[model samples]
Target chain A: MKCPLCGLEFNQEDGLKGCSGCKSMGACGLIKCPNCGYEVPAESGIVKFIKRWRKKTDESK
Target chain B: MTVNLSRKRPQCHSTADMEIDARRSVVLVGSPNVGKSVVFGNLTGMYVTVSNYPGTTVEITRGRLADDSRAVAITDTPGMYSLLSITEEERVARRVLMENRPDMVVHVADTKNIERMLHLTVQLLEAGMPLVLDLNLMDEAERLGMRVDTKVLKERLGIPVVATVATKGMGMDELKKMILKEDILPSGPPLRYPETIENAIADIAKNLDSSYGISKRAVALLLLQDDHEIWQMVRDREPERYALVDAIVKHARERFADPLNYIITIERQRFINTLIEDAMDNDQVKGIPFRERLSRLSMHPVAGVPIFLGIIYLLYEFVGVFGAQTAVDFLEETVFGQYINPVANRIVSSIIPWKVLQDLFVNEYGIITLGIRYAIAIILPIVTTFFIAFSIIEDTGYLPRLAMLIDRVFKKIGLNGRAVIPVVLGFGCDTMATMVTRTLETRRERVIATLLLALAIPCSAQMGVILALLSGSTKALGIFVMVMGTVFLFVGFLAARLMPGERPLFYMEVPPLRWPKLSNVLTKTYTRVEWYFKEVLPLFILASILIWAGRITGLFDLVIKVLSYPTGWIGLPPEASKAFLYGFFRRDFGAAGLYDLKTSGALSGVPLVVSIITIALFMPCIAQFSMTIKERGWKMAVGMAAFIFPFAFVVGYLVNLILNGLGVVL
Candidate 1:
């Protein structure tokens, strides 16, 4: 995912694996950008799979 | 895309062997938001995880690269501006450099920001790391008619420099080749400082026996700049020379009118400018593009207000009407009410003979009936819609412009444009926004932003519900907006006055506004929704259970009776007390309670407006309260809550009193 604030591209996983000191690490579910501390939502696995599948089909067309 | 060096033992950040790897291990380091991760992904495919850099909770990504005989470990560090660290992230990045003596240090920089970004590159060179500078994001830079001479830059710095469009895999082959060639990986001479500073550094470096994995000159420079970590390291490792080191640093500081750190930064900037002068060329046309003009208009004080208001209205229509009314009604009344709830109620009742256990699962506030319903049916659609809209705004690069537009207002509250990030974010979720307040430079700014967020900014869920409640009555909605706006400004001004700190200077790079790509928007929205569900679902269930327990013990009824006094004081009926109590758990749920009242013809006109205003201004939900405590500590969080609870009602009462006095009916 691209951080909108700083325009840095990072893996969604790196974003979700936020600072460990945060009390709501497991539950808050926000992905903190490693560069700037901007928080974005964590994308689900199913959505990612579907999007990839759709893109593949679209390219085939 | 893989480059392999000689086989040797891996050097992790935790290890202190001070053994430089004979085999090639690559470490990527740069300022944050410079596309280091993209470069890392291209270099090492699919072998990455969050590895803590020893004692700190900060995570740096460590990945493995493979070839025919040996595997090299590649570590991607957190963003750091210089060797002198200001943030924990910077400290971790510096530690990774000191502890892991990687064969090649890939300093990734955004090509668009070559001037500002070159300082870190100079710092890395001074540290005596074997450096390969990758100027990433050349595509964006070229689009702006800016050209960088990679050959000139290489000659000027005496290091291997590669220009790359990392996103499109441009210049990857050259970068890979540079990383693999051992002969090309030469240690450049450190940046020479002014003569006086050079003499002081030389005096200090003469006494230092160890560089501790970095150059002795770098250590000497850090000591002169009063780097605490270096001071501590010196105290622990070379106590005999610590006093001498301290005196040299003190003498250096006394010699300068400005702090030595600032002096050093200025010197570095001067050096960087000389380098940039030879390396970069600009041929930008006199006339700006239409997109650039639009970007300017979006930040113009007069023009930007209407655009901002338009965006807000669009947000209401999308998140409120389409999401809250259309999607929520279908999910709530049709899906859950007509199908799921009845089925779940029947199943729980048939299985459990005891009324208590059945009630816990199937009753009005049951885990499944209320909690799951609220999470999916009410909150999900609203948050999803808001996230999608927000992601589009972010991806289009309008946020920085918005920050510029509102910076004047923010200044009145002792905050600069940077505070706009958290304020805009508070609409998504105040809990997360509270956490983001950590990004602010000053304690005073963070505190004021925190107080304003808690007092006036409504989270998406709460905003969605309130918008749904009052959208039918335009007059009521207007009043609600006016009251919240007034309170936001007034409280922010007071807090700014009460707090103490210098107003920070505001400077931010505003990226060119572009059309938002569908893939990016969808991906971001999906990520946010997934995160939102992971956070809100369990909390909603716990809230249901707590409410059920409170009901079973009759505490719920007692609290409702007591709250009715304040409800009446705000000119709302006794029936409104239940909604107010539900609000303590979740703001949206409480607003949803009022929605039920309005539909059933219980709340309307002046009282309805008062109820919505008070609930919007009420203390944030439990998650936000805990986050406030985490970020601002217990005293500030508790104090904020204590002040806000009464203040919400007082404002509500005053609004009600004024409206009734005018004989106004909406």
Candidate 2:
């Protein structure tokens, strides 16, 4: 995801790696941009599900 | 050939006597998302192995080049902006470059952002690394009507330059051929500083006796910039000459008004500008793009205020009126009030023999009736809409522009524009925003930003509840906004005056405004709402159980009775003390309590507005307080709370006195 603040694009995994020391302990579900430390919420399971479903449908088509 | 890709501890200064392999090693390096990993894959194919750089969590990828005849190992280092590292990842990348002494260093850059990317390119050249400049993302550069004359660039920088859209396999063969060539050599430093710095660099380089993997000129430059790691290394390795080098750096620093880092960067940028002038063509359409014009207007001093107010009004309509009023009313009155509460009360009353046990699940303060209802019915709708609106705003890339718009005002408050990032984010979550204050350059700025956040900035859930509480009367809402805004600026100004600190410098990149992608907004909203529910629901239920326990133990009444004096002094009813008590648990809980009071005709008119202002300025939630303690330490956190709680009531008292004294009708 691209950091809206600094325009640095990074992998979600990389963003999570930066969050290892945060007090929220991943319960906050925020992904901190590795470059700028700007936090944005990670995608929820429902959204991921919808995305996967859409991708499967597209493939079928 | 078998390769061990297991994590290896970085040998900072010792590369001698390490096992040497016949395979020529190449390291791919760049800023984030410039296709370094993709280029790595292109060079190495499917035989890649990943491992953490030892002592750090940052990953390193290594593989052999796909060509069977030539034995070549390719390593992809973490993305880094500069050799003068700020982040751990950047430090690791620099370590990889300095320690490995790779036969080839490929600096993959985003072609569209060559201006920004060239800073790193210049640093690589200064290091005298065997460098190849790969201008990746050429398709994007072309789309932006940018053309880089690779031949001219190569000739100017005295290095190989390859342009490729790595994802499309464009220029892969050329890149491969360039990497395979054995003749690549150090391109030498690409810039010369002013005479003072040049003299200092020459002095420092002359004293260095031991070999640093990179050029001694680069070491001298890093030393002049007071690079701590190099300072330690030089002190360790060249102990006798370290003092002279340190004196040279100090003398050089005394000659410049700015820090050597800033001075050096300016000189490098000046060189890059002239270099770019000769080698690149920007054929972007002659006129300013509409988006660019809109972006400018959004940050314009005169025009930005209305745009800011316009955004606030839209938020009020969406989250306040629609979510807090309409959606909340349906969920609270129709779903919980009409259906869930009655059924739960009846079922609990029938099943549970003891009235105490029954009260735990039903009645006014029951876990099921109050906690669940408040969480699912009132707070949920409000925060959901808030998250949706916020996600849209963020996706539009308006926050950075907002930061720029507010920078001038923020400077007066001992904060640079960067503080705006945390302040705006505080609306979403103050706890997170407090954590983010680490990004500020000075400790003083962080403290001021933290105090302001704790005192005046209400999180999204709390703001939504207050907006709903005030939405009935525009005059009342107007006064509420006016009073809170006054307190925010007033306190911030006072904090700035009281705190002794250097004036903060402001700089931020304002990304171009774009129509928000619907999918992104939706996904962001869903994620935030999900997080909100996951975090808040259990806490609300726990609060309810604790409230029940406290009431039974008579602790709740004692606290509420003590709280009532302040509540009454603020012109609020005695019952409102319960909300004040709840406020410390979570700011939104208190606001939700007030929503209940208003609905029951217990709180109204001037008192309602005063209570909202007070609660908004009240001590931050328990989580935020703990975060404050963690970020600012115990003494500072305690001092802030000591000032905030009473100050909140005093301000509330004064607002109440003025409004009633003026005979202002709500």
Candidate 3:
């Protein structure tokens, strides 16, 4: 899947991911452009989930 | 691609005990207003308004950036986008990066929209600034069904990329580790351009012999686009090198179909795309996930309406009924009313001989007898339960789901999904929600939200008491709903009509539902209750002091006398006048007074209903008045009070008339 906006291609899991804020496609990119808080969509869930779970696991340890 | 950007040389100079060494200080440097303040506050211990919309954070807020680092100072800068500064704010951030250069910089970007944001990230990498990319608002990204393979992207960029939900404090640890490690080194096959572009870049890099902070190759690319900041920096320090860079940019600009910036952005996208393709594999089903399907059903006009009502009912049942009726009665009457106040009165009478002094401590309106008791006994328990419930809702991230569920309906009345927070919060505290109106995207939305909050949404105390009161009466509850619902919709529509503006679009990143964490919920509850106690306890005690003074001065009698006509008109007893006055001090106090009247059998059905209705529509507490003044200014606060005073009585009169006229004898 290609992020139509950014054109970052990934697989199915990457296409259907959510952010930590609200779990929708509204605010998942990184931060609102430090310049503008405009909402930007990211890739899907696989990479995002792995990264987050890894982060959480790291914290727990 | 984790890069070690930290190099230490600065002498220990900061005198503040809070000073964090560069090794410990993982500065979250990004463009302002990118939730950096929130990340800082959450990681460290601070309280910054999540949304004040004041973009220029002139002074940096320092927090002991918590996590794996024993104690680090996290710095939040005004919103800035790139290393190449165009705006003064950007220059400030760049200066921070150059001067205090912390162990690492966490680049927080709105995850939903990364294409535009990543440009700055790329620039930072090019500048070789120590960095970890935080794909913040992962909740928002997931809601929109966009996926980001940060690990893959991390591998490709060769920098530590951590995704975060800074608002809810998710992924902070991973972000911290990534920052502490400063592990990703920004190295890759520098993004290759088309052969023609490659030759052009080669020509430029060959001529430009400048050992800048970043690679000269990256400098050449920035120069090609005529990045003014970079160009200015080069011109000042290396005019000879800049002259060559200028020629390459002019030539490249001539070759590009679009503007040079656009052309560069396209190339950057190409690079990001290529990297994603190699490292990422998203395995999502087509059409919709079961969650999305459930969400669709939940938002359906038919199904959603019922669900919304059901949720509202549950909220009232737990918060209003259980909290207001059971917990409040037990605490206010059985505990405080029966035992504490009497014991305190006897003790104060025995200890203090001066009547005036005794009045201050244990009289009818004494601080101990009334103020502290009310704050601790009546408000605390209710607020604790409420904050716990609220934190859970917020943590589970159901609010956005509820927003989407009701967005369509809200749109019809000139509101959007964002209005959900204010309206829902109004149930907990209208004053707080009024302050939150700043979050609405538009001035019109703020006005409408504020109006709805004041006119309809009862603050927690009033709402809970009212809910408790009416929960027993099917007809009364139905009537209450009809009246409040009608007024909310009607006023919102009217405000939207009067306010001149384009209807701002509704967009919310509705995160997937999750079970709320208990500790997080408890912490949030504790914070809220502590704040509530601070605000309420003082005001309640001050109110008691005022009441005592009023009694001694005969001011209380005069006010009660003045209130008598309205009381008579509304068909209530003379003592009810005191309740109305207390209502102004705090709605819950008036509610407690009403309970005092009800339990004593002073007023029954019609008068009770009328009195309840009127007080519910009446002015909020002294604290609320002060808050209203602080937030909306004197004009709105005074005007709101002016309308509410007689308006409550007049409405009470009308309701009495209607019920009396209809022979509504319950």
* Best model per lDDT: 2
Question: Which residue segments of model 3 deviate by more than 4 Å?
Answer: A1-61, B1-305, B324-326, B352-358, B402-410, B415-425, B438-447, B603-606, B630-633, B650-666
* Residue lDDT tens for model 1, B166-264: 889999877766666544454655477777788888888887876678778888888887788988988898889878878887787776644566568
For candidate 3, lDDT tens digit of each residue in B27-138?
Answer: 5766444677677766655332121112333345554543444545567765665565544555556655655645566788877656556767776776666667888888
lDDT (0-100) at residue B133 of candidate 2?
A: 94
Q: What is the DockQ of each candidate?
A: 0.38, 0.47, 0.03
Among all windows of ten consecutive residues in candidate 1 chain B, which has the lowest summed lDDT?
B2-11
Candidate 2, residue B61: how far the Cα is off, in Å: 8.3
How large is the i-RMS for each model, in angstroms? 3.9, 2.6, 14.1
lDDT of 3 by residue, A1-61 (tens): 2221112223333233222223223322322221112112232344456668889999999
Error of 3 at B226 (Å): 21
Off by over 4 Å in 1: A8-18, A24-28, A48-61, B1-110, B121-142, B145-209, B212-286, B296-303, B341-364, B400-408, B416-425, B436-443, B473-479, B507-512, B630-633, B658-666
DockQ of 3: 0.03
